[model samples]
Target: MKNIWISCAGIHDTLRFTFHSQLKVMLTVMNRRKLLLAFLACPILAAAPAFSHEGHGVSHVKTSVTLRKRRGRTLHLIVTFLNQGRDAVMLETVAVENAQVLNAVKTAVPAGALVEAPVSLRFHDDVPGIFTLMLDFGEHGKGPVTVTL
Candidate 1:
């Protein structure tokens, strides 16, 4: 076999072109992966704030009552107040049936705190089986809670 001389120039060029084409395909795949990851992250980014502030932004006070005693037309109550706002609240006054009594010692409820106060309601006619109590939390807010008879 005499020295067979063959030109490898076309082979080298083909190899170089294949390598560049593969590189371009790899870069395109990488870009697509990045776009897919970004699309998947959108919902998680939007829901992050909702999960962090769950059950928050409640700016008003909540009130509940328990009947301590009932004698004739008078109903003694133990009113419970829950301040959900950021600032403290004061129970300024309580009104029932045209009678309003200013709290001598205002009940103070710290932020996110609960306080119980003794309240008496005297009905001139007849004490109903169930009644609604309206609480005045000064400038904070008002809560109207129903009391079972």
Candidate 2:
């Protein structure tokens, strides 16, 4: 290219303006990114309490009874008893109550570290709709865990 004589002061002014403009654009982008992050984090922070028990501590004996497998009217479930406490807790009465079960539920859960009870539910009606299953963990007194399916 052909060399053109430009004033030193003019070159300094041009560079200063370019640097300020680029800095302003970069600052605007950073601000937008920060605002977007705050917006996205608000809901998760607000909904944290709903998902977990923040105030309520972990239960000593946590029981979960859910259906493992289902074939027609016969439903199979594995009931899990988790002991979070340091002491060994004996889960006495681990029972399931539903409309399908005709006789007494076979809950032979002996006192141990971790207990799992396998249960089978036989439905009377051909078409099984929404049924409430109440799990009774007597003496352990954790909960009669209610489940709907």
Best model per TM-score: 1
* TM per prediction: 0.54, 0.41
Per-residue lDDT, model 1, residue 112, is 85
What is the lDDT, from 0 to 100, of the residue 76 in candidate 1?
A: 78
**Candidate 2 residue 147 C-alpha distance from true site, Å:** 3.1
Cand. 2 Cα-lDDT = 0.60
lDDT of 2 by residue, 36-99 (tens): 9999999999999887642232256677777788888787777776766654544443344334
| 5-62: candidate 1 lDDT, tens digit per residue | 3445787776776677677778898999999999999999999997665333324577
| Cα lDDT listed for each candidate | 0.71, 0.60
Which runs in model 1 stand beyond 4 Å of their true positions? 1-59, 98-105
C-alpha RMSD values across all candidates: 12.1, 11.1
